[model samples]
Target: MADKKIWQELCSMVHPGHVFQDEPLGKYTFTKTGGKADFLVFPESFEEVQKTVQYAVANDIPYTILGNGSNLIIKDGGIRGIVLILTKLTKISLQGSEITAQSGAAIIDVSRYALKAKLTGLEFACGIPGSVGGALYMNAGAYGGEIKDVLSRAVVLTKTGQLKHLEKEDLYFHYRKSSIAENGEIVLEGVFSLEPGDVQKIKARMDELTFLRESKQPLEYPSCGSVFKRPPGYFAGKLIQDSGLQGTQIGGVQVSTKHAGFMVNVGGGTATDYMNLIKHVQKTVKQKFGVDLETEVKIIGEDLKKQES
Candidate 1:
C-alpha cells in the first residue's frame, strides 16, 4: 500500500525501531483513550525531528507534534500521516540561574531541577503534569506562576521545517494560550530564567503546592488535566459543581467526585465517551449559569464513523 511505503521511508529517517505503524495512541496519553497513529515516530535528537518534519512536508503528509499528552484528547479514529512524539528528547541543563530543557523534559522534572539549583520562580510548576514544550505551547500554569512568567526564549521548528528562535515577546502569551499554538510551531527546547533563592524556602513552597495538587486533583485515575478554562470571572470547577454535574458518567468515564473539573476514566473509556461528557457538561453549565464554558484541553485526530465513511 502507499501508506506502507511512506512509513517505511519514515523508518529510514528515524531508526526503524523507533518508527511504529498503527500505534495505539492511548498508551502514551494521560487519558488512556484514543485510537491509533498511522505512523508514530519518536525522534531522539533535534536533527531527527528536523528530518522527520522535512520528509513529511516534502511528501505532503500531515504530521503532528505531541509532548507528554497531559492535556489532550485524540479522537477514536486515530490520526493520519506522521505523529511525532518527542518523549525521547528529554534533556535538561542549567547555567547561571537559567534552565534549558528539551521539549520532552517533563515540566515537573524541570521544576525539581530548578529547586535543586536553588531557583525560586518555578516552584509553582513543581506539580504541573506536562512537558516543557506543552507548558510553553499552552503557557501552562498552576498555583500563581505560569511558563510565560519565566520563559526567556524558545527554539521551535516551524511547520515548513525551518528552525526559529522565539523570545518571550515573540510568543505573545495570554491566559492558557500562546503564539506557538496559533502558528503551529513545534517546540524543540525552552530556556527559563529564574531568580536565585533560599533552598529551604523553595522546597517548602514546592511541597505545599504538591500537597494542594494531590489533595485537589483526582490523581488515582487516568484523566485529562483541567477540562475547561476559567470563564471570565468564574472558576470552571465551581461552575460545574454548581451545575451539579459531578459523579456524572458516560460510557466508562465519570466526572470526578473529588474534582469537579476533571473527568476520569473509571475503567475502559473511549474518546467518544469523553467528548460526549464534555458536551453534556458544557450544555448543562450554559443552561444553568448563562456562561459559555470553553475547553482548555486540546482534542484532535478523527472519529471512527468519519474514518469508516
Candidate 2:
C-alpha cells in the first residue's frame, strides 16, 4: 500500500520525475531477474539523498542504497521498501595527481578518466562493471591489483546520515570485501592518488585484461559475476569443472561450461533456478573432494521460494 504522507513528502522534497513507482528493478540489474521495487528514488545531488534518507528514517521505513546493480541479485519477491540507485549521481573530475569520482560513476569510467590523465594505477579496474561506490565498498579487484592499492580516501554517509571522510586504512579493504560493507556505511564519493604514466601503456595493459576476461567469461548470459570466491589452494572454477558440473541446469539456470565460476540463466531462469543450481554444485563439489566451497556473490532477501518448492 502506498503511504499517502510519504508520497506527499517525496513530491515535496525531490524532482517529480526522479521519484518512480513500482520501478522494474530487473532492467537495472545485470542479472535481469528481479521483480519491481516498491519505490525507486534517483537523487541527483547529496541534498536529495539526505532528504530521502531523513524521510525514510523519521517514518521508520526501511531503505537500502543500491549502486549500478552490477554485482547484486535482488530476489524474485523483490525488495519491500525504497531502493536508492546512485547511478544518477555520476560525477568524475581530476585535480592534480588525484581523481575524485561520485559513488555512482562506473569504475571503468574512472579508470578511463585516469588513463586520459596518464594516471596508471586504476588500469586494473578498467574492465570492472560496478560503480566506484560499489567497487570501494567491496574492494573490487581483477588480476592482481585491488582498490586498496590506489584508493587514498572516500566520503561516506553513515547509517545514521552523518557524512565523514574515511582514509584507505580506515576503509579496511581486503580481497573482495571492505569495512563499508561490513559496517553498513554508505559511500558517497572517493578520491584516489594515481601516478602518471604513458597513456598508451596504460591502455595496452587495460586492453589485455579486458581481452582475457572476455575470452573466458560468459558475457552473453545474465549473471552475478563469479559465483564463488576462490577457495584456498584451488580456483573455484577449476574445482567446479573438476567435479564435472559444467552445463548443469536447475530450472533454467546452468553452470557455464566455458567458465565454471559463472552460473548463467540459459533463458527464462529465475532466482530460484540460479540458487538451486548453486546448491547442487556445492553439494557435488563437496561430495567429490571433501572441500566446501563458498559463494562470492551476495544473496539478499528470502530464499523461501526455492525452499517451498
Candidate 3:
C-alpha cells in the first residue's frame, strides 16, 4: 500500500507517460532478461532527475540508476521502488580538442563523434556498449585503453543532493572501478580531453577495433560482455575455458563458446538462470584452481520480499 502511494505521488510529479507500473524488465536489459520493476521512471533532464531523486529520498523510496541496461542484472523478482533511467537526457558536442557530453549519451556515440571530429583518444570506446556515465563510473576500459586516459572532469550529484564538479584525481579511477562505487554520486555530465588527429588514421583505428569486436564477440546473441573481472595473472575467459565451462548452458543462457568471457542468452533466459550459471562457474573454478572469481557485472534488486519477524 505504501509502495503504491509513493508510485502514485511520483507519477503526479512527472508526466503520466514517463512513469510506468509493473514494467517488464526484460525489454531494458542487455541480456534481455529479468522479471519486472515496480515502477520505471524516465527523467529527461538534470532538473527532472533532481526532483525525482529528491522525492524518492524524502519519501524513503529506494531508487537505482539504469544505464542502457548494459553489464547489469536486475534479478528474477525485479527491483523495488523505482528504476531511474537517464537515457532520454542524451546530448553531445565538441570544442577544439575537448568533447562534452550529457550522462545519458551512449559512450560509443561519444567515441564515434570524437573520431569524426578527428580526435584520437576516444577511439577505444567505439565498441563500448554503455553510456558515458556508466563508463566513467566503472572506469570502463578495453585493449589497454581506459576512460582515465581521456576524462578531465565530471558534473556529479552527491548523495546529500549537492551538485559539484570533480576533477580526474577526485574520481580515483583505477582498474575496472571508481570512487563513485563508494560515494554513490550520480554522474550528470562530463568533459574529455582529446587531441586533433588525421581523420583517415582515426577511421582506420576505429575500423580495426570494430572488426576485432564483431569478429570475436558473440554479438549475434544477447549477453553481458564479460562476466568476471580479470583475475590478475589469468584472463577471466581463459580461466573459464580452462575450467571446461565453455558452451555450458542453464535454461537459455550459455557460456559463450566463441568468447568464454561472456554469458549469452541464445533464447529466453531469465536472471535466475544466469545467476545459477554464474554460481556453477564460480564453484567449479574455485575447486579447480583455488582462486575466487569476482564479477564485473553489477547485480541488484531483491529476490525475495522483506518479511517481518
Candidate 4:
C-alpha cells in the first residue's frame, strides 16, 4: 500500500474530480473483471499526465499507464500505486494526407476519421478496439495491416517526463511489440501518413472487415481479444479448435465457441478463472499439436488473496 501522505500529495496535484482512490478496475477493463486501484487519474491534457508521472517518480511511487484497458488482464488483487488513464485526452486532426491523433483517441474512431477524409491506409484498423497509444504500444494490427505501416512519427513522454519524437524506424515495431513499450514511454500523440482514396471504397473496406470480425470472433461475450500469439507456420485458433477445446469452460470463463483463439467471460468470471482457462488451453494445444502457445494479452497486478497472505 502507498503511504497516506503520498496519496494526499497526489490528490493535491490534480483536481479532486479527476482523481479517484480505491477505484474498481473491472469497471474500466474490457473483460469487466479485476480488482481496485489505489489511485486512478484521468488526465485531460498531456501536461497533466506529465505532472502526475513526474510526481510519482519523484516520490518513489509505482505507476502504470492505461489505454482503454483492452488486451489486458488485471489480477483480482488489483494494482498498487497510481493508474493513469488517458481516455480524456482524446483529440484528432487531419492535415493534408497526414492524420494526428492524441494517445487516448480510439483507433476505430481514428480509422473512421480517415475514412471521412478519404484516407486509405487505416481501413484495416476500423475494427480494432484499442486506443491510439495502445495500438502504438503493441503495434496492433488486423487484416494484414499494422500500426507500423501507417505511423510516420509519434511524440512520447519518457520516464523522466521528457517529450521526444520518435520516427517510425525508431519505434522498432515487431509482432505486437514496440520500443515505447520496452522503454516505458508514454505516447502523447502520433502522426499517420495515408494516401488519398475514394471515400466509398474506404467505407466498403471497413464495413467488410467489420463484418468479417463480427462473424469470426465472439462478439457476444467479454474477452481480451486473441488469447495467444500465432506460432510459426501455425494458427493458434486452428490448433485449439483441432484439439477439441472449443467451448471448454472453467468457472465462468470458457473457450470461445465462435473462435478458438479467444477465451470469453460468460458471466461472473474472475481473473483467476481466465488465467486457469488459458493454462488449460495452452496445455491441451501443446499436448495435441506439440506447439507452445504464447499469450498475446498482457496480464498484470497482484493476486489479492495471495497478497493478503
Candidate No. with top TM-score = 1
Q: lDDT for every model?
A: 0.95, 0.86, 0.87, 0.92
Q: How do the predictions measure up, each by TM-score? A: 0.99, 0.95, 0.96, 0.97
C-alpha lDDT (0 to 100) for residue 272 of candidate 4: 92
Worst 10 residues of 3 by lDDT: 300-309
State residue 6's C-alpha deviation in candidate 2, in Å.
1.7
How well does candidate 4 match the true structure in TM-score terms? Answer: 0.97
Model 2 misplaced regions, further than 4 Å: 303-309
If the candidates were sorted by their TM-score against the true structure, best first, what order would they fall in?
1, 4, 3, 2
Candidate number of the best lDDT: 1
Q: Which of the predicted structures, 1 or 4, would earn the higher lDDT when compared with the native?
A: 1
Candidate ranking under lDDT, highest first, comes to: 1, 4, 3, 2
The residue-by-residue lDDT of candidate 3 on 1-309, one tens digit each, is 476787778777777789988898879999998767888988888887788888878777778888888989878778877788889878998988999999989999998899788898988999999998889889999877999999999998876557889999999998889997679988999899999899999899889999999998999999977889999898888889999999999999999999998999999898888998999999999999987889999888766443111
Per-residue alpha-carbon lDDT of candidate 4 for residues 1-309, written as tens digits (9 for 90 to 100): 346776677667777688888899999989999999989999888888999999888877889999999899999999989999999979999999999999999999999999989899999999999999999999999999999999999999999888898999999999999999999999999999999999999999999999999999998988899889989999999999999999999999999999999989999999999999999999998998899999999999999787789
Kindly report which residue stretches of model 1 are placed more than 4 angstroms away from their true locations once superposed. Answer: none
Residue-wise C-alpha lDDT for candidate 2, range 48-166, written one tens digit per residue: 88778878887777888999988877777677677889888899999998999999999999999998898889999988889999999888988988999999999998876777889
